[model samples]
Target: MPLDEPAALAEGSSRLPTLEFALTGSTADYLIHASPDLLSKARAFEHWESTRLAHGLLPFARSLQTPPAAHTTLREQDGRDVRGLNFSSQDYLALSSHPAVVAAAQEAMARFGVHSAGSSVLAGNVGDGVALEQALADFLGLPHVLLFPTGWAAGFGVIKGLVRPDDHVVMDVLAHNCLQTGARAATRHVHLHRHLDVDHARRLLTRIRRNDPHNGIMLITEGCFSMDADSPDLAALQALAQEFQALLVVDVAHDLGAMGPNGQGQIGLQGLHGQIDVVIGAFSKSFASNGGFVAGRSRALKEYLRYFAATATFSNALSPLQIAVIHQSLKIVRSVEGEWRREQLMQAVQALRQALTQEGLTVWGQASPIVPVLLGDERRARLAVREMGQRHLLANLVEFPAVPRHRARLRMQVMSSHTAEDAQQAAATVAAALAASAQLMPQAAQTP
Candidate 1:
């Protein structure tokens, strides 16, 4: 069961303290104690149960003692540092430590304090939050924009705010979880096309329009699929939406601040700035800040979103410090320095992709930064991650439910700060770890 769903909490028990951490020994343990009824219904989760049991037979879950950085130190559960090259962070432009961005944030903190303390509809537009919104509007060539606390909230809140129960949303099968959640919450009629398949999306949209011509229709997709690290054809999607009289809502969370000419993202890459109906993106990736935005082609629609988008209206707006950091980051992203950083990032991505491929690994998707090394077998994938940690290389293990169990992979993110040497060494280390893990798999399976 999802963590948010109502579970069978102990009757008459006080609500779990909102300010406190709730730790359990395992997923089953947590579920059993927190929501036994939900766990009972989820007994068909064989993969989950099997993976949990296998963890005891192998090393897993290496602890990280610091915030994500290009070459940060990691730690074991016992607090010993693991010196390594980090391939887990999504700071693609290496701007998290940029002196200018940091200085802007500090200045905002000193001038405006920390928290916004209230929702935007109330009084949360602190410091230059509104100015940052306008700057984004001017940069994206959109008429207006509204900000949300996080990318997830922006994606979810926008869909729920715009569409109704009778409306239809045609989305990519591999759309982000928040997008899917928002669509499901907003409407009962939702259609999913194969990942990056423009033809399939067009067909779905056409069919939905034929049946529900008067109802609102939304064609949803992402500028870049984060896990797959591939992009859709924005021009083609825009044409299809225009033909069907539907809205084209593209979520550019992963690629907006990292790719394209001047870092304008996939929409800019495809020259669809004025063409796309709605643009949604996050500042967390390359912009060195938190919060996200929804850019629209019209001021009226943006005003509607400001008033109706649940996440924007109910949640507190971005902190003054966050806004200042984002404001400064955008200035950097639009400069010649930002272009140089992007070039370095692509160089690292291409080098790592080639090196990994030569090692007989199946690398998924076309290049844009995110590189998934497919391991296929869940047991082997987990063991490989553990072995990589032992080798002082940090990467993320993406497994069942996130991707199909058979397509389990190590989702490696390369940043501008990683050198050619870093990419090469990391690939070699990953290959060696995978090889060692494969050799131990049979032994591991036979042990218990």
Candidate 2:
């Protein structure tokens, strides 16, 4: 469980790469790093040791790197500028580099400083921030909205703030990590139904309601499942929530800005707008900015969250420039141009999906910008990523425990900025990479 143990244990296996930590001693030696507690140090050591095997076997997935742009092109991990089609970014709309968005950010930064300097509850709250919140609320057609530094925080904050220890949470097994963490932290009873299985969810809810009818219950899921690129039956889930008298929290991070007419996302697609109890989304995906927002039907809920959500209360609010960029991005997303972009994005996604399927590769989920190519073998998945990188195509490699151990995949995100030609090329490249990787990984790594 020490820092040197990974290097020692992963010895002489060419497949496992060595990780060099700057800290020379065990985690216990760094008790003063974050806290002056011995227990914290020991826990940190255990956490590191638990993942040491995976770190040894698959270091490529988490290697240090930086993304250069929001377009379909990106730089390679070797510090080389490669014109690879980028499928790793969450910028579905590709609005991050839009001239208008950039100009607004620049202008705002000139008028106001870079940092908000304080938490939203205090001096950090700016007039533009208020306007941005209002604009988001108006766009979503929700009565109330509260902002957080990141979409992860928004998901975690709402659950932690609202759910008491006695309350019960029923979430999809594939719900975002932030949501799962929040549920575990906030409640004693957390039930996970199978991914996108509304019937299973209903059965679980029925059992929970029968057992604890008087306590608060929440149904947590996402507008779009990020890893699977699939969507649940929202209307069915909504009905179940109603039947059980449970509040529904749908994280719309992946779909809100890139899907549906006028970019209303899955809620709009299902015609369930303003009906769901809580709507949560992030600006990172479609808004082309940082930060996340939680919206609901009551001003009192937003006010309560503003006070009680520890992440929002203790953290600094979105910067003035981030606010300005999101405001402009929202405006763009609601415009005719936004619709055009969404159409383009869908076209690219469909083209890529079709191409991959035609190549005999399985692509998961319904129509969305995210298109995950299923690769059941982890060794092949890693080789596929590396081969794709060599062929100038940057796709994300997702393995366990992000997906089931046997369900490793290449999670690709299609961008509006990507052309039909880009999609074609990316799909072709992926096909070639998979074929090549098959030759490389003779026998799959045995399940741990």
Name the candidate that leads on lDDT: 2
Q: Which residue runs does candidate 2 get wrong by more than 4 Å?
A: 1-83, 442-448
- Candidate 2 lDDT over 1-448, as tens digits, reads 2444433434353433223221112334434445556565555454454443333322232332344343334433333444566777778888877899999999999999798999998889889999988888888889799999999999999999999999999999999999999999999899999999999999999999898988999999999999988888898998889999999999999999899968999999989877888999889988888899999999999999999999999999999999999999999999999999999899888888888888888999888988989977666666677678778887787776677766788888888887878878888898998888767653323332
Tell me the TM-score of each prediction against the true structure.
0.87, 0.86
Candidate 1 CA-lDDT value: 0.80
List model 1 lDDT by residue over 59-136, tens digit each: 235565665677787665445577789998888888888889989989998998988988988899874988998899
Worst 10 residues of 2 by lDDT: 17-26
Worst 10 residues of 1 by lDDT: 17-26
The TM-score measured for candidate 1 stands at: 0.87
